[model samples]
Target: MALVAQFLVADRVAVAFAKREMASQIRSGALADLPCDTPPPTVSDVSIGGFPFLTQVLTGSFSDVGMTMTGLPTTGPRIERISAHVRGVHVPIFRLATGGDGTIRIDDMRAAVHMTYADLNAFLRTQPGRVHITPVDGGRRLEITATANLPLLGDQQVGGVTTFAVHDNKVTLVPSEISLSGLFNLTLPLGNLGSYVPQIPIPVGDLPFKLTVTNASTDATGLSLAATATNIEVSTADQKPCRPTGS
Candidate 1:
C-alpha cells in the first residue's frame, strides 16, 4: 500500500510540472492577452500514460503525458477542453524535484481542443445580420436561419443546413440546404446567398513551438481540434526573471 501511495503522489507531482510548463509557455505565447483580465489557465486534469511513475523517473524518460487545460482562450472561441498526448518526454524529474533546473523535451505530441457552439456563434455573429446559426438535426447540423427583405417577396425568413469540414487547419462551413421556403411562390432577389461559404480561420495555426493542426471535427459540444508538434524543447535556461536587469 505504501508503494501505491508513492506512485499516486509522484503522478500528481509530475502532472503539476507539466501544467506549470504549459502555463508558462501560453502566457508568453501570442494569445496571452486573448481574454483580458481573466484568470490564468490551469491544468484541469492529467494522466501519466506509463505505469509506476518511479520506473519512468529512473529511466529519465516517459512514454506519454496527457493534459487537460482550462481558461485558455482563442480569438474566436473559448477553449473548453484541451487534451494533449505527449510521447517521449525527456526531462530530469529528479533534479527538478530537488529544486534544480533542466530542459524538458518531447519527441512528438498530439493535442485535441474542444470549443463550445456558443463561442463559435460569437465569431459567426460578425457576418451579415441576415445570417444566424441555431442548433438543429440533433445538433449534428447547424440550422442557418436568414431574414431578408426582397423586392416582390417582401420580408422572408429562410433556413438552410450547413456542412462543416476541416481544411488547411481551419473550419470550413458550406451551406447545403438553401432555398426560399415560404417565398417560393413569389420572385425574390436573394441572389446566391446560399453559395456563401464561411471559413473560420483558427488561430491554432500560429501556435507556439511550431505546433500544426492536423484535423478538426464538430460535435454536440463544439469543434474539436487535433494538432501535432515535433521536437519540442522547453528549457529552464531560457527563463526570464520577474524583472529585467534595468528595471
Candidate 2:
C-alpha cells in the first residue's frame, strides 16, 4: 500500500509538468503571431513658388560610369500623422529634399529628407490613424492604402493616392506614376521622356526602403531608410541600426 501511493504521486507530478510545458509552447506561438507595428514619418508642408527645376550629370566612363539626375519638390504631403495598428504605435513624419530652391534638380539631387527612429516613435505615439499587420507564409506584411486632398503648385488642388507594402521590415511605395513634364524636363535621352520633354514621376517604385526593430516593447533599437534603386543592397558599411530614441 505504501509503494502504490508513492507511485501514484509521482505519476501526477509528471503529468502536471507536461501540461505546463505544453501551455508554454502554445503561448510562445501566439506571441510570434502578433503583427509588427510602426508609424510612417511626417513630411514637410511647403509650396514651390516657382517653376520646378531639372538637370542631369554623367560621371565615370564606359568601364565605370555613373549618372545622376535631380529636381523634385519636397513640399506637400507633410506627414501630419502616422499610426501602426499592430503594436498601437504612432510616429511623426519628417521631410528632406535633395535640391535647393525647394525643387529637386537633377544636377545636385541627393537625399534631402530623413526621419530618425526617435522621431518615428514619437509620431507613432501621437498618430490618430492605425496600422494593421497580417502574418503571411514567409513573414509578416503591412498594407497601407489611402487618399487625401492636397494643394498642387501652391494654389491648385489635386487628389493624391498613396499606397505601400511592408514585408520583412522592407517598405515599398506602390503609387501610380505621375507625369514629370509639368514640373521639369529631362535633358538626357532616357527612354520614354526624350521626345516629350522628359518628365519623371515620384519614382516610388525605384526607391527601396527597409526597417529593423529590436526590443520593440521599449522601442530600443531600429534602423530604416528610403533609398534609391542604385543604392539598395546589403553591405557592411551601409548597414545602419537606428534606435527608437532618434539617435
Candidate 3:
C-alpha cells in the first residue's frame, strides 16, 4: 500500500512537470510566425488528456492536449480567446520532464478564435460612423447602429441587420437592411445604400500554430473562427535544461 501511494504521488508530479514543459513549448513556438511587436497572447488552462499518464510517458505519445490562449492580436480586430486542441503529440518523456532537448511532433491541431462584441466595438470606433454591433437571433444576426452624416439629413442614427460570413481569411459583415431613425423612419435596401454603409472586415490570417481559417460562427458570447492544421513540429532543442526539483 505504501509503494502504491508513492507511485501515485510520483505520477502526479510527473504529469505536472510534463504540463509545465508543454506550456513553455507552446508559448515559445505557437506564435513564432507573428511579428515581433505583437503582444504575446496569454497561454493558460493547459491540460493533458488521458488516464494513467505514466503509460503515455512510457509510450512517448500524448493522445490529446488542450489549451486556451487569450488576447491574440490580429491585423484587424483582436482575438478575445483561442481554444486549441492538439492530438497525437509525440515527445521524449525524459526531455519533457527535465526540459531537455527533444523534438515535438503534433499529428493535428484544431483551434477556435473568438472575438467579443466589445473588441468589435473597439474596431468599429475607428471606422467612418463609429458603428456598434449587437448580436440578435442568439448572435446569428447582427444589429449595427451608427451615426451617419448625410447630404440633406446631416447626422442621423442609422441601423442595419447584418450576417457575418468568412471570406479570404476575414470575417465580412454582410448587411441585409438599413434603416434611418428620424422624425419619419426610412428603410433602405442594400443596393440603394451601396457604400453608404461600410462592410466591416476583420482579418484573421495571423492565427498562431500555422492554423488556417476554415469556417466561422457566432453565439451569445461572440464570433468564433475555426481553424485546423496537421503534421506540425516544434523543437525544444533551444530550450535551456531545467533542473529537477529536489525532494
The estimated TM-scores of all candidates read: 0.69, 0.17, 0.81
Per-residue lDDT of model 1, residues 88-144, tens digit only: 878776676566777767799788877787876776667543466677655676777
**TM accuracy, model 2:** 0.17
Ten contiguous residues with the weakest lDDT in model 2: 53-62
Model 3 root mean square deviation, Cα atoms: 5.6
What is residue 188's positional error in candidate 2, in angstroms? 22
What digit string (tens of lDDT, one per residue) describes model 3 on residues 1-247? Answer: 9999988988897788778767777776665666544556678999999988877867788899999988666777877888999999887767666746777788999998888888888887887777888988889778989876665777778888877777666677766788988776998886756566777677776677778888878898888889888998777654333355572
Residue 232 miss distance in model 1 (angstroms) = 2.0
- Stretches of candidate 3 exceeding 4 Å from the true structure: 1-4, 36-39, 96-102, 147-157, 236-247
Error of 2 at 57 (Å): 67
Error of 3 at 210 (Å): 2.0
lDDT of 2 by residue, 125-210 (tens): 33322211222222223222222122343321112222344444344333222222223422223234222221112112222122
The TM-score leader among the candidates is: 3
Candidate ranking (TM-score, best to worst): 3, 1, 2
Candidate 1: segments with Cα more than 4 A from true spot:
1-39, 94-101, 146-157, 181-202, 207-209, 237-247
